[model samples]
Target: MADVWAKISAVLPGSVDQFPLQFSDTVESSVVEILKRCRQQLYSDSTGTNQTLYPQIVVDFSWEKLNTGTWRHIDKEWRRVYSYGCLFKAAALCHNSPSAEELLQAVRTCDMGLLMGAAILDDILQVIVRILQGEVRKSTKEDADESERTEVKRIKIQCPHAPAIKEELSVPRIKCPSLESFNTNYLLPLKPVILEGIIDHWPALSQRPWSIEYLRSVAGCRTVPVEVGSRYTDEEWSQTLLTFSEFIDRHILNKEDGVKGVGYLAQHQLFDQIPELKEDIRLPDYCCLGEGEEDDITVNAWFGPLGTVSPLHQDPQQNFLAQVVGSKYVRLYSPEDTDKLYPHQSQLLHNTSQVEVENPDTERFPEFSKAPYLECVLRPGEVLFIPVQHWHYIRSLELSFSVSFWWS
Candidate 1:
């Protein structure tokens, strides 16, 4: 515990000192004062003022600057401020001897800042996040080990939606075709296909099969943004950060009875954050079919409980949706049928369809009734190729972990 605290305490001072220009004088003075008060609290009998309090307010003010229409072009200063607030907030909580959950929240704050803030702040906080994660893993090791040893049964895969759709409409399937064959038939024609046997060499499929326990042990303490609701297009949809174990307990294990909402860790650049998990997956050789360099490939993770939905949507890049655990029922419609699918008018949701694929209302969207589509049940060890701009909807059939690689 002493060593843990020492590692945690060493994170901020020297690292932050390296980037003198990163923090404005006024910001630095305020942080210095708060940190001074935090150190004072360490020896005081009673808990001193929480230096961690103002960072959230600072974060909020910095966040407000992103409300401008041209947010992509936002001044870098605000991003730096946001990162500064998050990093020191973690430091303050550490000095105050925060609870395990408090430490986790501090890590979450830093992750949010990293996801939305400046690149300069990344090197400063990376060590802090790792140390916090290590402390969390140490605290939860006993419970995690016990839970891992206990085998909990899972419900079988269920494809209760859209039962009447034609089996003939299923996406074309094949074993690992030659690169030339794949490019000639599928890539050039912009066709969707279910590819098999291509990822047999992946450690995720064999040595480190992505069980609930394996994932929990590997990344349970790490904070990730999770989508809460049936689907993001719904009115109640929102995103919040949670540790991987928390997400597994609430969403996967169904640990809390009577909880009605879904929580999904969807479309996150998880490989970039946790490189250990990255070692388990190999970038498909098929990505080389693209004109871009291998570094241009974008990998995202999707994990969720049964019945989580991704509404009918299209992406700009070529995609390989790889199923590592559980299964998914996927439905796809061509870009030629875009008008029939009735996409949302708002610029924000322009890529998403208003009509639900399985339970679409013909009275409201008559054209949707006539839209031709293809479908499949993607299983573990199978990868589904989705051509660019092809509208597709997906629903998990059980507790699932999937990786998607996107390339042009």
Candidate 2:
């Protein structure tokens, strides 16, 4: 498999490989020639077709080296490029009919000129590379010669904090209920509410014993191990047993491969079998919104005994995490406590010290000593919501399956 993929990869030039030649001053001339050829092919003066109209150009490239020496035959691979099919259709629709003002209006209203420009650039670069080098190689010594000579400067970005809450000198203070109430009131007021027992209601677990087995089989579990976490290889993760019953009896029961040997589960199948889980899943919707929307949403699920103790980091969206089976411990800090967390030097808001939260290296993250936090134990069937820009770390307690939904 590795050899086959290596051969295939060697034959294709990825986008990054074509980047250096793309920005050359020669690109403009290449685009003009390609566009002119396209206009001629689609609308010729002899045919009485309008020459003023711009026809969309689809450009492609390939190469072959002639050998004079050997009688032996060797097949050489060639690279091919197709204009994004959509671009060609769009170009046909906008053909020479629209005035320059009308075209400018269309380009602005549709906002696709930039995308068209980028595609044209990509196609132009491929052709230029082929014209310059008769044969395509993964990379060439010429690439080093053409490398940008300018020094790159790093720019620092700053995140602005919300305005401070004004102190009310005249208003009377209300009393708290107990020590726990006072602790909640004075420290970490916006802590997450941890709920347990949601998994008990999951239909697959209750109605079918085979469902449990199937899940265990998919998870590659024999006797559930005592230790908390594990990671699996890709091949171990792809095996499919259709019904939950076949999964448990056939896959789970036969565990010659140790539990830890199991890799990631089939993500799509996991969602397909548990359709109800999709309702709560939040995918990033970036098209209509502005910048940062895409990076704000990320979902990750884990099956099998495993725990990830990530260093504290603040995200823009709130998190709704559900533990399907097993238990985990969580510790959280609020946005206001940024000063106490000992953040990084960059513009990133939360400078979560790289030191593990469970056991900190006080010498390096001395400011963490000033940070106050709330801790909770989340059990199977429960959900916990970590608020926007809050910091947290998780540790799995036993064999577990969990899903996390994050959104603004």
Could you say which candidate leads in TM-score?
1
Q: What would the TM-score be for candidate 2 when compared with the true structure?
A: 0.39
Candidate 1 — which residues are off by over 4 angstroms? 8-17, 23-73, 95-102, 143-151, 155-167
Candidate 2 weakest ten by summed lDDT:
149-158
- Evaluate all candidate structures by whole-model CA lDDT and list the values in order: 0.79, 0.40
Off by over 4 Å in 2: 1-190, 196-200, 208-212, 216-299, 304-307, 346-352
Question: Model 1 reaches what TM-score against the true structure?
Answer: 0.83
lDDT for model 1: 0.79
Weakest 10 consecutive residues of candidate 1 by summed lDDT: 151-160
205-294 per-residue lDDT for model 2 (tens digits): 454322233342232211121212232212232333222322333332332344343322324223422333443343322111223465
Q: Please give each candidate's TM-score.
A: 0.83, 0.39
